[model samples]
Target: MYRGRRRVSPAVALLLASLGVLSGCTNAPPPPVVESTSSTPTSEPPTEPPKPKVVVAGIDELRGGFNPHVLADQSPVTDALSEIMLPSVFVPGEDGERVLNSTLMESAEVLEDTDEFTVRYRIRTGASWSDGPPIAAEDFVYLWEQLRRQPGVINPVGYRLISDVESRQGGKTVRVTFEKPYPGWKSLFDHLLPAHLLKDAPGGWSDTLDYGYPASGGPFAIRAFDLDRGEVVLMRNERYWGPPAESDRIVLRAADRSENLNALRSGNVQLGMFTADASTMEALRGLGEDIQLTTMPRPVTSTLLLRPNSPQLSDVRVRRAVLAALDRQALVEAGTGGGPAANLPAHAQVLAPSQPGYVPTEPSGEFADGPDPERVARLLTEAGYEHSGGKWIRDGAPLNLVIAAQFRETSYEAVANSVADQLNAQDISTTVVTPKGDELYRTMLATDPGVQDPPRSAGIDLAVAARPVSADSAATMAAQWGCPAVDPDTGRTSEFNMAGFCDQLLQPTIEAAVTGEVPFRRASERVEPTLWSGAVALPLYQEAQVLAVSREVSGVRDGAGFAGPFSSVGEWVGAPGESYDW
Candidate 1:
């Protein structure tokens, strides 16, 4: 239901143009050959040759430095290794709707006679690690144990859905069982690591400019890495178990947006990721036959997080007043969408309609117009606050609030400013604080009640964050709202409920969604209303993973329509120029 914004990374453009070098975007005709004349004969026997496959170039800061244990800052690096190293049970389509198959275990049904919540799995019998070791139950058990120990490993996105992961191995069979029914069980398909290789490896795994991430389980492996030069190369695995991957090798290079655009135009690379300004998108659009450009949606949302713990924002009235004043639709229109931009407004709860537990709520009428300073003044007065001249007095104190967001993203900063202006009209002072990434995260981590060792307050009032939803389920929606999750800071049961907000009324519905014996779909229908009424997480547009491919390449399709362009890589192939299959 939510039409997402197009993602166009610079690297995607370069790759599309590179295909022109291999073969024209339009099919190329056979080359004319000079025949040998009066050649003394001889053909003893004829030998058949192998087919030429399409070679693509991907962009990752470090082709090999991706780690499953650490918070991944490198999407490109993860995308490159996803096919080989990452593991998930199901993958989302380009549209951020539906699911796709990966290394599927034969059966995933819960066992009826089992002592606990166990599900039987018949892992693809022949599945093997990149090092030729067979993929078995032990690997899963080991990985889960390792993950539990390193709880700080970010991207716990969908991983927290499970209560436990137990495995049984005998001969070539492997069974994975869960402690509870994780509604979005299909999300675990993106990446799986090799337990044997990392079992004894110190510090789990890491990436550096000089070293690669780890051995892969996908079609390619890191053949070369150079951090100083900011580039890496991938070669096809000759002993791949499944149908040999279409491409034997893919070369990836790192470059800035400008450099990536230049590469696409000159045909130096065959594929690139593109995300730039409107002018940049327009420029690439005019390139025509030289390179092919297509837009895909990425499952990402941009938000303006409000941190309430700061001295200036201790009052609940200030926070509510801020939300009441700003124009959310205007912000969505100004910042998102393609060209003029088509951003999915976060008027309702965070999850898209396509996602489970999604209930559409009216945006225009839900809250009042543009921070009505007069209205805010009334609310403050009701809360025992008085506006004396220009300053607000709450118990003889000034009414002020501090908002935080990273300085890099101008859009969020603009949102902060707009909110500030509206709140200011009511005589409530607002300060917008912009910090760098590490500084901001550390500040928030220490102050946020959810992630801190000992939460300073009821969690930062608000913090803007983004995560890819790997599955469509009610649990996913709840996680985004920060509900029912264990609060690391307080050692209390809390969801990412950063607002330190909860509704006892909604708990039963949420519990039903989580522990219901009925199907996940049924549970979702039953739970959506509770979230809608509570105003959980505010929704935002779903951004796309911008991917550019050369016309010479064929059979490329994304599972979630055009959003996740890499969802369908199994059928991709090289163009049949002379003798190669296109």
Candidate 2:
């Protein structure tokens, strides 16, 4: 007879199994039956919920100060965070072209295009920050007001031209009027910050984003930043209006090349972007097809700044002597660390190698492979310096200049050391100093104080630093060489200008270029020669970076020129993740 037997429920079966009642064969299981002891019902065993799916990306640097507009804070981590956390009006499309971010903005147009230009931006309806406030004109006004007058901003020229930022239509529509025609107006107002929270924050503009964002407008929100642990986690923003992030969490793990490779091997990290060197590239190539490598060129050009603010280097002839004493080819070879930048030796002072209309502006007086001994000696003599005991002496004091580079920045430190070595070999007294990057840029480079209320010393005589060149060429030129004005309130000079020194003769030309009254090419042509002859700085190479993606991670690929792999982080999928390692 074909008789069917009743089946026990899952919970009962689990309880029975725990009571030694489960049997493989149905016929055999009829031998014994388990009974409950009390009125309580049996329940299934507890199982853990699925772990949060996470994708960790390995990067080289992860210092805070993520305000995208700040110069000292412009790093790989900043760019990655801003692309995913902050909303932008225009972003790089699939083909690297400027495309309007339809998610945040409805439309942007040139309303008035006469001598005084005006741009109108309409924020999308219902587009609000992670907080309750709407993304509107106040954000634009905040960025402009800060960048235009901030001491250590990235590029303020475009923002400085703006005469006013007018809020219309209940603060949704923003009308920005430029004092002069700004052709690169589209580049302004990127990564709009939460003005309402940060405007009167205790830390002010410099410390607006030091810890984490107050509100998120993009797909992810900052969960935590544990600097000591070198890990920053971003979780999917519950209040995000756009499509949900593919991964539940994304982690930015700051590590070295070996540490990154180890994480990839352990399936801990799926993507890595590091400062490429010969050793790292060799090992990465040995991995065969396990990882994909892409070379990226950054916007900054690595240069050796001979700061004229230093009394020792104030004389142009001495500065020229220092430049002519080094073998720049050797500097490039050592500084590039046999990376992609070794081939792309920069020749322009104002424009980056990737920028449009960039031309090699290497001066006619450039140093050769081996420095010209005669030129070095003559320049030093002309600067009232005499070589005594194999060291240059001026006015009974040895001309000992200190060259500083940021500590932990391998490439820049290499360049500074190499420069010092070359100078020592050429009988030029030089000392090398490596300070923390924040101190080097914010405290050392930004200040050139005189004897006053808070007396300060000229910290670094010269610096091996990267000068960021943006879409606005005029702004770049002015930032490097423009004359800083005197501040009446502080009774001190403006620290906005890099080099802590500027040429009055080229100031008018820089201003004209910033205002768009003169063409970029013409202004740069006039300003570049003075910079080179004056020995203000010597451009070595552009910042070349690399991106590596593990095949284990899906949707990990290159973005475009100057676009990092994190641009599409919302779509990445990874393997099952374990609990947070902390």
Candidate 3:
């Protein structure tokens, strides 16, 4: 089992107290209040309440604006921003469970025993947007039409199944009829935009709101956005129907990895998130006990994806030999700094170990603990390869393979170097390539265009990348490894299926899992074995999201998955008597 949070050493705590950073030490009692010296009955003017302290948070760049309907802006930063400024019918809990947001919705249920599947939702009486427009059924209808028409947008799979939406009781009640049964209907309307704002935009609904959001319906509203300065300021929504936010304002700013660490050391930022490697955690420990670290398993897993079209990996034996030559445990330890509490070896591609529905596939005898040179040589020989002059040669040609990873992922680059060294020691010739920016994505989605006499290889035999899984295990699995989503008109493929993995034999099982025809565990069990046997991708380990906070901050909670660290920001409170100039 994975631990949610790890405690620091006792020596670090002592250092924090000595530096006057830890505020939890013992304190003396306060003095009693004394009576006023003067007996005059003169009245004094009332004093205004002190302003709430601003909490500065560091995050990556906010790409694609705040509107998630636009495919480009649907990033982790957008997810965090939406949690603070949008109204949702269902909210995700810290334990990977969904709960109703009573502030926006009163009740949601499915009509029983009907030929047509329909869901009814009742909006809260006082729910209104920041600009004084009521949150009505018309907003949902508009959202459905936009998403239904734009199939290639961010998440249109579920909306495409809905046939119609009807509003009753003057926009208070909504009825949604689906073309088929969808057990995961609660995940549909997590964020809804105000219909009145975008209904009259010029070009199209998908591309109209690409720059910034105009209004908010949640606890916080956008005060200012300066793209050139890379800063966004949010203040409490005075028109909110629920209780006021605990903190008056939040400031999100873009910063590099080094800048984020420096800000935490100087008390400029109260909280930040990063991919915690061992070195980063050690550096934080040196900064004293004032800095606190908490970790939770992320929904992403690192894998080495193989191109089936490549001649070197087209043979199943050659793929098996490649797996047997590398030590997955060492790679995982090096990538995560040997912190068992922070990371775990990945056993399945469809679901993370901490997720709800995960089944461990039986290990193949090869590559379980460490490298097996004997197994590698045996497999290579069976595939008509022989060792010669420290390299495997077949048909008088050297069996050289190229491995590549993105330059931005430093940890992954280190792991790729280590893999190359290990494979070379076992008489396999492997070269490592590091591509930056657009070149990296192009390499991952490489395919033959059939323009030449002989089709060339995808230019990479194996690529190192991370696959992000969702709480809905079935849908995520289908999207990652099932049939490719090809455009009917352009003959272009969806970006989701970049690996180009298409197995018709498993299509029915994937459909059953996606449509909720079978239990999650049963579907997972039936699919994981086939995925493992094919060896198209090899998962190395699971990554954990690391959050650093100051000792003065409280009410910081881990999200259900990768929703964001600020899911519970409304309840956050700073230390008493602390002064923040913002």
Residue lDDT tens for model 1, 1-582: 123445678899899779766776457676799787976765434445554454455452443335534433334455545644444545555555545444545555556797666555567766666668776666666655544333224434345444455555552454555556655555443466666767676755432311654566556666766777776666666645666677655556787766776777666666776553476667666557756665554444555544333344445555555566566665554455243234344444445433445455544455654445565666567667776878878777786666655555455565556656656766667667765544444344333344534444223444444434435445544444433455333566532333334455655555556545455555555455544434433444544345667676666664453224444454566543223121
lDDT of each: 0.52, 0.79, 0.72
lDDT of 3 by residue, 1-582 (tens): 123335778999889777664443558555699888898865544555565667788875654445665433444566678788878888776565877788899999999977888999999878988989889898899888776544324345566568888999989899999887877778778688878888987744655555556778887887877777777888788889887788877888778767888988887888876666677667766778887777766556777877565668878788888888888877786677665323567778677777765656746573557899899999999999989898899999988888877665666787788888888889889989887523444334434333222233346777776666655667667766766544433566544343556678887887677678986678777777777777778887777756778876777776665556676787777543333344
- Ranked by TM-score from best down, the candidates are 2, 3, 1
Predicted structure with the largest lDDT when compared to the true one: 2
When sorted by lDDT, best at the front, the candidate numbers are 2, 3, 1
Residue-wise lDDT of candidate 2 within 405-458, one digit each (tens)? Answer: 877777888999999988888898788898765666666787644533322334
Model 3: clashing residue pairs?
64-73
Worst lDDT 10-window in candidate 1: 573-582
C-alpha TM-scores of all predictions? 0.73, 0.85, 0.74
**Candidate 3, residue 504: CA error in Å?**
2.3
